[model samples]
Target: MMMNHCGLLTERKEAVPLKSIEVQLEVKDHVATVVSTLNYENKEDKPIEAVFVFPLPGDAAVCHFSAQIGQKHIVAEVKDKQQAKEEYDHALSSGQQAFLLEGSEEISDIFSLKVGSLPPGESASIGLEYVTELAVQADDGLRFCLPAVLNPRYQPQGSESPSVQVTSVPASLVPYSLSFSVQVSSPHAISKVESSCSLEPLQYLNTDQTQATVKLAAGHKFDRDIELLIYYKDAHQPTAVVEAGQASAKPGSLMGDPVVMVSLYPEFPQSVMSSHTSCGEFVFLIDRSGSMGCRMNQKRPQETRISSARDTLLLLLKSLPMGCYFNIYSFGSTFEHIFPKSMEYNEMTMEEALRKVEKMKDDLGGTDILQPLQHIYSQPCIPSHPRQLFVFTDGEVGNTKEVIDLVKKNSGSHRCFSFGIGEGASSALINGIAKEGGGHAQFITGTDRMQPKVMQSLKFALQPSVEDISVSWDLPKGVSATILSPPITTLFQGQRSLIYAQLTGKSSETTEGSVTVKFSFEGHPSKNQLHFSLKPAEDSGLTVHRLAARTVICSLELEWKPNGQQNEEIKKKVVELSVQSGVSSFFTAFIAINKDSPESVQGPLRCRIIPTPLYRAYIDSQVRQCSGKIYCPPSGPLIVL
Candidate 1:
């Protein structure tokens, strides 16, 4: 079951005031003892007398605690395990100044600490020490949870007074599950088991997942291996699932579109197919112009974009298959390769590549990408494997069409992916080039999440399912199609073939028919056939495998750019269709919004949250994506409505 972080929000009917209550913790470990101290604070000046509850991990058994307020400090220690009950009984007894309550403890079970009156402008702290033999076991991990009561202890005050507010602590920042583990029979068995480990509070900064330090013993490979699939839920709502994919998005979509994807494995079904093994050659066309200096780490410790690209290249070298080949080419006013040509993997080559990547720093001058793409295009030594060309720059080139045309010409043999660095870079031009090259385009938001997508793009480009796939659909009579997951043959190895499209003109009765898909692969038959049944599309849960196959040609044509007048007409149709379908677009929304005079809202009180209908729809989709572990942050913090 998915877990939710819960919160309580209270507002005064008359007075415009709010109160927040929170708890924080610090932990220390010495020898066999684990000491945990919690700090509780009431943000509002009003007195807060609510019970604060915390959870201890299942293994640890509480020994005693230290409590204090002003000059009253009390420490309780039990000489024997049986005598621990006395300490708790004494704490529950109220005192003149303050009182404490203790609960029973069990091996590795969660225990709660309750704090009663934390007055406004006043705070309290308490400490607990526990012992656990599990700490010495192989997986030395720790986790803790704390929950607060909002307005738990309240007198019948006027309704205008502020009530206590509580929020679920940020799970990623909270202390939980420090380690994870999985063990398989063999390296190959790793794929079969597809071990999954969960890490708590994965949302915090400075958190990292690493392979454990322990090594395989002499007789067998490491007894324990761990892979983490962290799921975090915000307390404000139910748990959700958020998916990530690298597909090109419809135009005008928010740059922060949530990617919805799932893991799969077809070949070697025994292996857990969370990730794909990929191979491709990386050709880095770097820009070293003077205007580009601001992009490099110039005087700062942070490496510039060019340096970042090089560093990313080094990381790719380390992560990609050992057989993958790569070449580095840098450009400014001129073009040059760090190596004479593409080189295969080896310790010496990696060292040389790393050194060269580091030295090819910021060289200020005009930016020109054509020269390098042309230079590489001119080379006869291009690797025979699936070729991937990565152009990294600030996107200030003179003639974008020239690059686009050049990319289109060579894309039959290579997929050219472009990266636009910095905020001012040209999105349209980079996107255009990628579309023409039959590759994907991505903007480097920042250096942090760069390598994951970059590597994925290369992998996708290299392992395309079927090249030049063609489709044609003709209904038996009065039939039409509304394309959904359009036909694209860049399918990965382990993922399923999820083809979706909408159909119109069918009766309430089922329709019978077949659709065809044709495509050619290198050294294969001139064409291959894929036939499927045509299902009548409905407004609800319609499966369009047939329509998807029929509309593959239209989806291909979606990439075509028309001449001046024709282009305008096509753009108009795209805008109209996109709006009517409720799909986002790069070209349509502007026309719709500008043509209408939107109604305005003016009042002392306004709806600050998104409409419940839309918010729930989006959240519902997210809940399905992350397998109930992720939660969509509610519109509480957004003022869309």
Candidate 2:
């Protein structure tokens, strides 16, 4: 009997916790290596698996070969443990077709598998090495999916069929599917459609404008370009989506370019779950550690980690709902409450909080985040309302597992979100805590334009629409979550770092689903939910992130120096997250030194620097003007640490 059991993901202001991820990217000799290390300690008794999956950007041709299980090897304990590996080896020798599906294409023969035992109280690694030839790039982005089935008739002891689901980007119109409600530029607008097989110019905005149509033949695809041609009396250049005079007759292939030209960020629901009320208690745990002094703002810009956090936090407070209770908690070696915890929202407290933030001094000490978090959780004056704790820091503590568990236990009645500031901040740890705490994680170095990321997070707090939205999967016999987590799992936006697990069994039904969410506000409880049912096949847009990561990885294979054409191309791809995956092309910040104690620096100091534009100011300030080869001052060597 296939018993269908589901874990309820409620939309409680104080529901389950979520954790985020920290992505580290390294580039050497035109090859970008992305390391996404998320540390999750299973509280359950039995052994389990963790899976991570993401979309693949660029064409399938870009990926050369792939190797799985580099550092840690994973094995399944069936009726016979050794027999599982033997059977897997047999499958590979038999030439069974294995490929990753992306949009409508397939990336074949990309992975080499290995099997090793993983006992309880231990960890295993599922490493993926795929060589790509495409010039793809991306930020801390990757598509992660957790499949259900792992072994045949050898189900995990405490595991359930896992379901995986992801929200597609808006404005993304997939052919042959139900199209979204679209408003064209004009009702009578002329439409030009082109594909690999044919080009059809529909009747000039005909009377039957109710629907637009374009047809493509079987086995034929095209890089389609849609344009609107306008005719005006006065002289005006016809604005076209592509280069002028270039017709949509034969659109060339989008090869050697970044596949993730566009990206779709998830829009979290705001309203609270039904049967719940917004409690006004909030604690802003600001990390004023010494690392916050690092300056990223160059020349025209003069900014540091502290200043950036201050500016963004002020904006967030400004958007706070009137009469909302809040407090500030700053941490270094010791915890200090900037303001007394209060339930009443008033100008006095707000002003006091703002002043405390401005006057907060930098303390050079090891980061012990749990101290301040525990303080907030232990407060006697705390109300029963939904509580929020925001942590901002630029470093990782020694004890990650202990701190995460503490946050999870204390967060039983509150939501915790983390903001990583400066280079030293542990993006993964911050994101993980937020995930386990059922909140979101964000990273703000000097590079990111503060408004967008900040506003996005605030919008979530102002009006939370859904609560406890958990994702799970159920795979057919043999397949299981590969990249990370085991079969049955839970996902939270901020707390959970995104990961994709690789599957090594026969491909069949790959089902993903999410629990309905509830929200309560204005003394009214509202109900809402979204679900998806996808089969494991070539057409399912499941492997978008995997493809994207492979694309960037492939792009890095070519030899490219700093400020060179290849370098610029990589930067462009990194910004476009949809077609790029992993940290293959994310630029790095390095320090260079040789023969110290030079009299003076000279020439255009050509050195490898971080990707962000904000760092240019520091480079210019230190490096003196000169021609040809330049030298670094003895004390002023180029450094990113």
Per-residue lDDT of 1-641 in model 1, one digit per residue for the tens? Answer: 11222222221211111111111222211112334454444455443333322323222334445554444455533232223334333322321113233322110121323343334444545555543221110111221221110101111112222221122222222211222212111101111111122223222222232111121122211111121211212111111111221125443222112211111112322232233345566676776654344432112335455666666666665665667778888876566787887887677787887787778765634455677788888776444566777777756443444467778788776677777654334443566566567666655535655676676655556553354665455445754544354445343333223333344444444344333444444423232223333542222110112122213322432444535546666555544443333222223211100111122112222111110101010111211110111111110110110
Note the Cα lDDT for every prediction shown: 0.38, 0.35
Which candidate should be chosen as best, given lDDT against the real structure? Answer: 1
Report the number of the highest-TM-score candidate: 2
Report how far residue 472 has shifted in candidate 1, in Å.
Answer: 7.9
TM-scores, in order shown?
Answer: 0.40, 0.41
C-alpha lDDT of candidate 2 relative to the true structure? 0.35
> How many clashes (backbone N, Cα, C below 3 Å) per candidate?
29, 87
